[model samples]
Target: QLERGNLRTSWRKEHGHLRRAPVRASPLWNAKQRSVAAMRARVSRRPHRPSAKPKPAVSPLMLALVCCLCLFPPCLIWLLWRPSLGQRSWFRSPSPLPPPSPLAPLGEGNWTSALFLGDSSFVAAVHAAGHAFDAELVDERRPPLLVTVAEKADSPLLQNFLQSSILKHELRHWLVVALDSGVCEDLPDDVQWMACVSVPAQQEPADTAEPAMARPVNVKAQVLWATVKLGYDSLLVDTDVAFLQNPLPVLADYDRAHQQVRCGSAGAEPFLPHYPWLGAHVAESASTCESVIDLQAQRDEEHGIGAGFMRVKATPGGLLLLSRAMALSLKAPELTLQQSVSQAVGQLRGVITANTLPPATFPSRLVHLARPSRVFAYHQPCPKCVVVHSSWLTGHAAKVWRMKDQMLWSLDGPKKYYSDPKRKYIEYSNPSSMASQEAELNALKAAFMLGAMLDRTVILPEFRCHRCPTADGKGTTPKCSDMVTRCSLGAFGQLDLAKFAGAIPEDLFRERMFRYNPLTPKSAWGGSLFDSPVHLSFDSGKGGIGSLQASPEPGWEIQSSRAPEILSGAEVHPDNVLTPAADGSPTEDEVVAWFGSQTAPVLRFEHLYGLRPQFRHPARASAFDAMWNRATGM
Candidate 1:
């Protein structure tokens, strides 16, 4: 068996070696191999060629040029087609801003009637007087005939019509409306053909009756309702309001829109969606309430309605709105007429749309000429504003009348005051005493600041004075001689240079006229008072060591090229007190004197003109007129 196994293993090994060994080529394979070997021998026998060298590294300039070439085509295309692309259907061009629309013009036929109401006949008369002033300025073709509503027919206040000066100017048709008795008595001269309405008597006091329990019994509301019923569009102006410009033009736009009612607000707050009563409803709908909430917050920041000025069109919707408001007022006596109107309008959302005049056109605060407070100070009368409400100053009739006189003076006096050369100096000079001058200056400053705050374009007298060279050898400068006729302060120290700085250009510092000369100092050149680092170069013509130094106290510094030579005989001129050293350099004493005298004025200028006005602090008198002139573009 061992011999057989060994023979088998040897046979297997022999077979494995045979299998591992290369198989002998077939006749066709041997011929193909011999051909391939002959082809290789033929290729190797041919001449050999060197491989190509690697390409040199690309240059930065060439790379940049290639990159630019790649990017330029698209940029060029965009520039060429930009305008046309904007005009494409998918791309919307930015819309141009709309032009400002002017207020509509008011004509006689615009309103059927103008209703004037007052708690007392005197109050009504005062308002009518103010209205007369405004009426003269209006271009009404046929102004609405004035209608005055009084509490009683025989009220003593209305008895002496001829005796009153205000009534003599404007013809008013009186209507006696007994609110307590629900009796309205129309006068024989009633232009609208208004009839007396008989209202039912109330079991409770007339004031205590509620609209829900009974019909609304408010005379004001009744007057509004009756005006609408008569088929006449009405303008209800409270007695305390002074019409600055005619409001009919503003009302005409609303008339065209078919807007039932329009009201002026006491403040700059917006109306409509921001009504206080709409707050609850806005809170109920969170998803749709964002706009309403934003509007409410904005309006809340502004002032509410001034029911004193209202426009009611002869539309059923407007009448209904007024009626609803009247009913609400009757139910809630605590609420004001304006609040009632707001609440009623809130409830009747889509039924009535009330227009509101912009607050800029109908500012709430009256321009108080006397005792001007900060609240009234910044709220100067806007030239475009239709009315100025003085309801807050009702009890101060004397002050109001004084303000009226001042207004008249302002309107008429400026032309006369500016034209006469003889009066110019006196008018601009200190008025009688320092105290009075100071007061007048303060008043003028306040007026300027207030005008600026209100964004009113203030017209000032032009500065036509001659340009004078300053004492400090600077070029000729424009003198505020016409505006600032006299300085109230004894010395320049008291002058408020900062106030003057605000009105003039920033280069005021370099003007030599305002510079201080130690030997021959003059107050006219007030600019010298500020302490600024001025560069000075000294040329002795001959080379020598010179030094410039600043004093510690007055803080004046001088940089010199050579040491100053003390001349044995230095001539000092009377006008030019400064004596030049032998080396033509100013001595330390001369520099000190020049700088010391100017120190106060410089500091004052820095405090006044160099800085912003501290509105809360009282302004100085000396700087007031000059500053005013600057502000007004004089």
Candidate 2:
């Protein structure tokens, strides 16, 4: 009270006579204060300002909401501008590798050793190729290429170094680390894929969704790991590849070794099957003949083939480095980390310096299995090539070196090496785009099949197959018989499935189905059922599944909605099985990848023989019946 009294007296003393002049207030301050008071008054009246543009008389709750909305615009723009730094990265540090140790004695200065490392699991193929060149399989305890797999899947470097066609380490002291591709790597991209009964093109089943899953047990990482662990040296080889003679006598010149690679050959598709047995690969002495069907072992042993031969000179330090790489790839938490392994080995020095004087087999060196009698025979009794790879265009590889014969080049000349005929804004030259197309094709096929099985229709934009056969006389013949043509499905509409059967690759489906499926029509099963035997040039055997005199009717509706697991095998008798679609596995991605890549038209010849219902398109009755009548020629 005293303080108030003192303030009142001071005011009275200063303004008692100040009333002579009227105090004029500025509109700016008064307006601001009034506005502020008005704002405050809003809370006492109503929470929202009905006159404000955005109804701004905000409540504590509404103010918070407006702040969030204003903030979102900038946040979303930032996200759009940024790239995922390590989102899909395959890079890793150097794998933990064993010390490089020599398998052969340097006492014989430069006397090199060659080892074949690949999916050469077939005992017959191994023995036939080994004995053919008087070569021996180094099954003795030795280290394989280093690798790791934290998650069960092949890393990038594993595919390029071991599962790919290029023989990066074709060493004199060779070591082959063979493994199954299906078990080692995710054969198909796991994303943008589905596993379900019905997948409508527009939307998918919401309640049950599973990630696209593919498991890879990398061959390179495993081999590198084995090499480090075993402490031995060897030359690596793919079971699908072959040699004219034992490379033992061929390692005289370089600091290391040299083997031919069909640079222009068709890149081996990762999903293809390979030699399928591990037990007798060495002691049996495989390379005795041309075709190695006898090594016909169980189906599970080799899910896919290794890329080809890689020559490694048995340097004491080399194995150590590889072992280190292997360690990084195969460690418990992360197995088959290929990028790390590759970075380590890529540190090794070398380049492709072709020998001035080439070998005879090289005159027509690498012959890719364009045809699907597809069992590869390594170093047949007398090898014709210094080396051969599993590349699809291997048949044309020799043409690159054959300066004498411009005629040797086949149609499939430019693989990853050459550019397609130019057209503005075309995608063949775009690796990134190509990958996307392949992904979409695989996704579409998967969706279509799943939808069909569930008696539903799936809409998909039309696309191209993985490969396409050359137009008649459309491609050049640089080699004797190899050929290729542009096959990106987007460029060309639906492929002539019959024409593309060879180039698109038939084994992914055929081998998977016929490996031990006694019910499959043997002769035409590996090849296209629609293709005539006379046109097939890869057969060294009595062409066709001649044994399929009578095939059983695989009981299923012409357009029945059923699970693949429902399909039973013929061996069990149609009446006594768990399902009708036993041939198809748990996921359809692999099947679709194979199907999408078909360069040929798909003709379920089994339908023609009345071995099964004629319809394959099960989405619509009208479509299925029309196809049935067409196939039956009704």
lDDT of 2 by residue, 1-634 (tens): 6896687678879889756444466889789989999988877886554564554566889888999999988866665543332212243222222333324322212211211222234222222222211122222222222122222122222333232222333422222222333423332333111110111112111221211111133334334323332343334443334343344434332211111111112343212122122222322322322111111111111212122334332344445444444334333324333344344444432311111123233221222222221222211222334544433332222212121111111212123111121110100011121223334443334333343433222322223223333332123232223221222222233323333333322212221112112221223323345532111122223323342222222321122233222222212223222222433232333333323443221212111011122134345545644543442223
RMSD of each: 25.8, 27.3
Report the C-alpha displacement of residue 367, candidate 1, in angstroms: 8.5
> Which candidate number maximizes lDDT?
1
The TM-score values for the models, in the order shown, are: 0.31, 0.25
Model 1 alpha-carbon miss at residue 202, Å: 11
- Scanning candidate 1 in windows of ten residues, the lowest lDDT window is 292-301
In order, the Cα lDDT scores of the candidates are 0.35, 0.29
Ten residues in a row with the worst lDDT in model 2? 422-431
> Whose TM-score is greatest here?
1
